[model samples]
Target chain A: MESLFTWNFASEIVLSTFRMATPLLLVALAELYSERAGLVNIGLDGIMSFGALAGFMISYLTGNPFLGILAGALGGVLVNMVYAFCTVTLCAEQTVYGMALNIFAPAISAFIYRVYFGVSSTLAQATLMKTIAIPVLKDIPFIGPLLFNQTPMVYFAYLMVPFTAVFFNRTKAGLSYKSVGEYPKAAETLGINVVRQKYVACIICGLLAGIGGAYLTTCYVNTYSDGIVAGRGFIALSAVIFGHWTGSGVLMACLLFGFCDALQLKLQIISKDTPYQLFQMIPYVCTLAALAIMGAKKAGPKAKGKPYLREER
Target chain B: MKLGGKSENIIIPLIAVILAFLIGGVIIAALGSNPVDAVGYLVQGAFGSKTNIGATLVKVTPLIFTGLCACFAYRCGVFNLGGEGQFIMGAVTAVWVTVSWGLEGPLACAAALLLGAVAGGIWGAIPGILKVFRGLNEMIVSIMLNYVATLFMGWVYTELLRDGSVPQTFPVPDASKLGRLMPGMRATWGLVIAVLIAAGIYYFLFNTSKGFQLRAVGLNATASRYQGFNVKRYMLFSFIVSGAIAGLGGAIELVGTQFRLMSGFALGFGFDGVAIALIAQLNPLATVLVAYFFAVLRTGATTMQVGSGVPTSVIDIIQALVIIFAVAGMAFVRLPGFKQRMLNRQRGKKEE
Candidate 1:
């Protein structure tokens, strides 16, 4: 326990904590956008599975991680297109459609994997994304080694933080997006295309979530498996709620969850007396606690999961 | 020439099923297999022989209970996604009782079942109480608790109740075992109990005053409260009942089919129940038929995989597509094209 107080151990834990939180950060932000636009993308789980499989398969076949990332984003766009058709166009219940997509995507990915690679070779490893350290940024003493020297996806995720915050708060398109979520009828009256805005927002949500899923496959585990997402996508959903559906809040929530998860791994190593499963359960338990405490107090988009039919009063 | 009526409820689902199957066939074709042959194998495998049919019935048994669980809560306007967790908790609780107490008879089995229900009910009630008092989203709460229940059950099994030399618990006693309905098939008397439970849920939801209150709350909570119903209490009551039903599903599966509790037992039956409930439109009576349909798909999925060399995950794809179409098609039929068709049909009828 005394050895754990060393700077090296602390840095490693902090580094891993941020690294682990990257996927959650991405997905939570994605969910935030959709939820803010009044569409509940409950199928983020499915999107992740689709993205992971597509991303991994592309990278494996072509040996290029960039292509994998693009494929992941495209896969997400395709899935969310179906979601948009159902929820936005058909005016179906958002949650139910999302749930269906969630169930469907995994099967689609799994079946494709089976057909292409055969059922027995599912565990075949793929080319992983390479980590690139920023040259000058890496020279800074304490902070440089901790934050600057990490994977490209990590930097991209952090860069997205302010960009999303600005887009949500500063831009005309952002206000229109919020208006559609809060009051679609009023937004339509104001000449904002409510359906179009929702479609766009949800598609973007899918893109970010898909990239997050690719992050899981390419950066973290580097191999696709059944249940590889391992409830991270769900955790990301919870992070959106826990963060109170803001970019900064989402960042904090992801960090908190990542810290819990990283700490669990550390504790399991340091202490053998405790059962490892208990440690493994920290993030989920923390989510429940957070939700229970915060509960439904924070009001999200007023028309969040409701389908907007233009003809309906 | 009616556009919207009671028949639309039935018709929409039928259309959804047809559309989903068409899409599923397309997927099969994409996989380089003959869609007709794949489907033929699926149907034949599901009900090819009496034994196969019996196995399908066995698959349908737990689904019936879980479907009722989802339908019951949904009717009262609550989403109980924790059915997976509650189901597992119930199974483990029953397994723990039978193993720890060394009980051997039908009476002991009855006790274990009751214990299972109680444990599952408690597991479910946590989220119910939270939703009522704290005003949390029950769906999210249920999702989180599922992980907790899964991990907790695994811990209990490995640490306390594990059978010697194996990952599973000790075998349940013969006296406690449910009697097989068919000589050569795995179908147990649990099927009858499942049917009875479905009937009971139907009666309770449609025939009783409380049922009416529950349904009223589901339709409009504010109106139900204005009409002197305790909406909060009913919400709580709805989840407890839902949990008990799901827990009973776990208990039944344990004694009747598995006879021992292992890790990963009763995989995703609760989630399937949600799908079943959606397909049935939250009608308890309809859940029986829907559960049977799903059971056929699931039971025959293995045969479809073996004979056609296609993965059984295709069944999941079909199930998901069915749900998507069921929700989407119901709304899509109200669009301009369908409305125009309805008008044309009405004009034709007038001419006739």
Candidate 2:
């Protein structure tokens, strides 16, 4: 146990935490945008599934990871439009539409994948994004190897943290966007296009979630499997709540979940006697604990799950 | 054209179903298969023979329970998304009772079922208690419990209850297995039990004053509270009852058909239940019919795959499309313009 807590093992765990947390961070940010705009989309998992397939297939066919990422974001936007139209235009229940998409998107994605690739014993592979080590940053002792030595997408996710914080706290457009969520009727009276703002939020949420899904196929793993996105999408949703809907808070929450995930994976490899299934349950259990501990007092946007209508007084 | 409130409810869902099938046909054609032939095969496969109908009914059994679970919860304005978890825990507990306890005969079966319902109720109460006492979001908590329950079940089968070389629980005693409806049929008494439960739920929701209070709380909690209703207790009750239903379904599946706990048991039935309940507009009796419809689609998909080379996943797409259309159509009918148009049409007909 003492040997296990060495500097090398610690560094490895830290690195894996960042690696595992990347997708969660991205998806949580995506959820943050949607929740802030007063639309709660619980269908992130389905969007990610679609994005993963689109990213993998595009990368496989074109031999370009960048193109795959682009395709993934586009695919996510396409699927989210269905959700946006149903919840935003039709004024339907947001959670119901979100849940419907969760079922719909994954089935359609799997269907499209089978049509393109057919069933085969061997899994198809895609080109993975290459990791780049920053020159001077890499030489900064402990922090350098832990953070600087990573794929481009990982850096992009970290960069989004500060950008999102500034966008939510500082920008004028951001204020208008948030107002729609808090008081859509008031926002409309003030000349803000509430429906347009919601549509835009859905698009951004879908794009980011898609990129997160793409990262799994094009950077983390070169192959796509059914249910590959797993429950990370839902975990990200919990992170948004755990973090209190703040960008930095979400980042910390995601990192904590990632750490748990990484530790479980490592433990499974090292210990044979212990049931690996118990280890696998750590992240989900942690998510529940985090949500319960957070105490849902001031959870999110006031109008968050309520359908907005322009015609209603 | 004359869209009264009652007629609109029935018409909208029917239109949604027709639209979903039309879109599904287009998808089949796109996949280079004859859509008409595929539909024909699908219908024939689901109801052509006694054996096929029995298989379809068998598939419908668990779905009816899960659908009723969602129906009950949603009627009380609670979203019990942990039906899958509750179902799993019930199956696990039933297996523990039957195999470990070495129980046999009808009494053993009854005990296993009872214990399974209790286990499921406890599993569901966690989310309810958290939501009521701690003010946690039940949706996320329930979803998290799903993962935990699945993992726990995995541990049970792989490590705790491993039978021989295979990663499954020991089979229940033959005497404890549920008797089939017919000697050679796959369908068991589970279907009758499910249908009877549906009727019980319908009666409860429609007739009882307690059920009225629950639905009243769902419709408007503030109003119900003002009228002297215990909103939180109703919410918790819905969760427990919903969980027990799902748990009972799991045990039934085990004794009635599966007879052993294995991987991939009762997969996707929970979400399918949610979809079915929503499509049925939260009516318990309607849920049974919708579950049967979904079962027909599911059971037929395999035969359709064999006959036309179109993948069974097309049915999933159709089911999802039905949900989207149904909700959207319901929302559309509620729009002011549509309502006005219907009113105007009715007035014109009256004058004429």
Best by DockQ: 2
Query: Which residue pairs clash in candidate 1?
Result: none
DockQ of each: 0.67, 0.79
Error of 2 at A195 (Å): 0.7
- Report clash pairs, candidate 2: none
What lDDT tens digits, residue by residue, belong to model 1 across residues A189-299? 999989889988988898999999888888887788867776787888888887877789889989998998888899889888887779888988888788788877757
TM-score of chain A of 1: 0.97
Per-residue lDDT of B207 in model 1: 95
Candidate 2 lDDT tens digits, B1-352: 6555577777888999999999999999998999999999999899999999999999999999999988898899888888888888888888888888877988888888898888889888999999888888777788788889888988988879889899998888998887899987899998999999999999999999999999999899999999999999999999999999999898888888888887888778888999999999999999999999999999899999999999888999999999999989998887777788889988988999
- Ten residues in a row with the worst lDDT in model 1 chain A? A291-300
How close to the true structure is residue B253 of candidate 2, measured as C-alpha lDDT? 86
Instruction: Estimate, for each residue in A1-313, the C-alpha lDDT of model 2 and write its tens digit.
Output: 4557888888988999999999999999999999999999999998999999999999999999999999999999998999999889888888788889888988988888777777554788889998899899999987997899999899999999999999988999888988988989999999999999999999999999999999899999999887788788899998998888889999999999999999999888778799999999999998888877777777678999998977777
For each candidate in turn, the TM-score is 0.96, 0.98
**iRMSD of all candidate structures:** 1.7, 1.0
On residues B180-249, what C-alpha lDDT tens digit does candidate 1 reach at each position? Answer: 8868889998898889989998999899999999999999999999999999999999999999888988
Q: Number of clashing pairs, model 1? A: 0
